[model samples]
Target chain A: SQTIHQWPATLVQPVGSPLSLECTVEGTSNPNLYWYRQAAGRGLQLLFYSVGIGQISSEVPQNLSASRPQDRQFILSSKKLLLSDSGFYLCAWSVLRSEAFFGQGTRLTVV
Target chain B: DQQVKQNSPSLSVQEGRISILNCDYTNSMFDYFLWYKKYPAEGPTFLISISSIKDKNEDGRFTVFLNKSAKHLSLHIVPSQPGDSAVYFCAARRVYGGSQGNLIFGKGTKLSVKP
Candidate 1:
């Protein structure tokens, strides 16, 4: 069975600090990876998605960026955090035109 | 513009009753629809899905119905239990577009099934 792992279940950081959230999938190769954020009282918003290594498509322009370093390893990063950057971040993986599997999300609080 | 919309922000139901959650999409190109359940502080879990070719799909206690003409879909949970209390999100995907695997989610409806 395939499973996704995301680190730092909860994070508290100061403004202008750097951010790094990692996500990895096991039991699958060359799967599509995505990053989504849910702001307070809002739905899941797609931030970025990657079909392969070093290929990323961003949906919304903001303070965050995503990278796919390996076939199953994805990272979401930010050079400087903003107060508006706080939200629930989720990592998901899926095969071509299939339903996605999600990892435990990270709750980021930028103060 | 929001491609997917869940009009209801919350719902209350009694145990053993059926829970029906509705969703609508504005994009005609979306060929796949899905439903997900989520608890606070956790990621959404895939519950059921229906393709445009099929109007309905069932899995255990969950059933998803799609109306392509109306660009709408619904999820029905039979014999709703207390454990069914959570937020339900509706998602749609365009298979032929460049964002094939990318899902567009609607604002979730919080369901509360009381015993």
Candidate 2:
């Protein structure tokens, strides 16, 4: 069974502060990883995706960036958080099967 | 330009009745369509999907139908239960890309099942 793990289930960050969210997958290798954001009671918006290590494709331009350090480890980061950055962030993984599996998600609030 | 659209913002249905959620897209190049169920404060889960080659696909009590000509798709949940009440998102994907099959999601519809 494949599973995804994300840290800091909830967080409160002051404006202009740095941000770092980590995601790791187990029981699978070389799987594609993605980062998505959802506003309150809305759908997901793709931010970035990676097909392999050190390779990332961004969908929407934002204050955030993503990296794939290892085969199953993905990280979303920002140098300084903005008020608009507050939202629900989700990480996912998929492969040839094409079914995306999501993480528990991190609820971030910028004050 | 919203490529994917779930026109309904919310829906209510009696428990044990059928719940039909509709979705429409603007692009015909989209070859794969999917439905995802999301709960509050959690990530979205993969519910079901249908390829362009097939009009329908069924899994358990959930069925997905795709109409390429009309650029529409739907998800039907039979005997809707309280557990089925959540935000459903319609997603589409293409087979060719570094992001192959990486879904482009719709705005979503909230389904409420009343007992």
Candidate 3:
């Protein structure tokens, strides 16, 4: 069975602070990884997706960025956080043309 | 423009009754549709999916129906229980072409099944 791990579960940071959220999958290799954010009263918005290492496709342009350093390790980062950047961030992994499995999302609060 | 749309923001149902959640998509190229369930502060979980070729797919108490002509899909949960209370999201994807694994999601409908 494959499992995705994301941390920290909840984060509180000041404005203009750096952000780093990590997600990793076990029991699968070369899986497709994605980063999604759900703002208040909104749906999950795709931020970035990677089919392979060092290859990332961004959907919405914002302050956030994603990187797949290892085959199963993906990281979402930001140089400076904005008040609008606060949301529920989720990490998911899937095989080609299949349903995606998600991690326990991170609730980020930028004050 | 939102490719996927869930018109209902919330729904209330009684236990042991039927719960119907609806979704519509504007893109004709989407060939795969899925339903996901989510609780507050948690990630959405894959509940069920139906391909464009098939009109209906059932898994246990959950059933997903797709109407390609109308570009619509729905999720039905019979004998609804309190545990079924959560936000449900509809997602669609174009399986062909270069966007095989990308999924577009809706705003989700909050379902509350009371006992």
Candidate 4:
């Protein structure tokens, strides 16, 4: 079975601070990875996705960025956090255009 | 513009009754549709899916129906239970020309099934 893991279940950070959220998948290789953010009472917005290592595609222009360092490791980062950057961050993986599997999200609050 | 839309923000249902959730989309190129369930503070889970080629798909107590002509889809849960209370999201994927090549989601509908 394939499983995704994301860290820092909840965090409180000051404005202009750096951010780093890591995600990894086990039991699968070369799967598609995606990063999404959901504001309170809003739909999820796709931030980034990677089909392979060292490749990343961004959807909405934002203060965040994503990177896939290894086949199954993806990282979402930001040099400086904004108040608007606070939200629920989810990591997902899919294979061959199939359904996606998600990890327990990271709740980030920028104060 | 929002490609996928779930107009209903919330729903209430009685236990043992059927729960039907509706979704509509504006894009004609979307070939795949899916429904996901989410609990508070947790990630959304894949519940069911239906391809454009098929009008319906069933899994256990869940069934997904797609109407390509109207660009509408629906999820039905039979014998709704209290555990079914949660936020439900509708998502769509176009086989081609999707930005970031990812699934697009709609604002979820919170379903509360009371016993």
Screening candidate 2 with a backbone cut-off below 3 angstroms (N, C-alpha, C), the clashing residue pairs are: none
Residues B56-95, model 3: lDDT tens digits: 9999999999999999999999989999999999999998
Task: Looking at model 1 chain B, report the run of 10 residues with the lowest lDDT sum.
Answer: B93-102
Q: Which stretches of candidate 1 lie over 4 Å from their true place?
A: B97-99
State every prediction's TM-score relative to the real structure.
0.98, 0.96, 0.98, 0.96
Q: Candidate 2: list runs displaced more than 4 Å.
A: B97-99
DockQ per candidate, 2 decimals = 0.81, 0.72, 0.83, 0.69
Give one digit per residue, the lDDT tens place, for model 4 in A1-111: 899999989999999999999999999989999999999878888899999999999888999999999999999999999999999999999986788899999999999
Docking class of 1: high
Q: On residues B1-115, what C-alpha lDDT tens digit does candidate 4 reach at each position?
A: 9999999999999999999999999999899899999999999999999889999999999999999999999999998999999999999997655543479999989999999
Interface residue Cα RMSD of candidate 3 after superposition:
0.9
| Tens digits of per-residue lDDT for model 2, A1-111 | 999999889999999999999999999999999999998755799999998999999998989999999999999999999999999999999986478999999999999
> Looking at candidate 4, what TM-score does chain B attain?
0.95
Decide which is better by TM-score, 1 or 2.
Answer: 1
> Judged by lDDT, which candidate is best?
3
Residue A15 lDDT in candidate 4: 100
Give the Å error, residue B54, model 2. Answer: 0.5
TM-score value, chain A, candidate 2:
0.96
What is the fnat value (0 to 1) for candidate 2?
0.74
TM-score of 3: 0.98
Off by over 4 Å in 3: none
lDDT (C-alpha, whole model) for all candidates: 0.95, 0.92, 0.95, 0.93
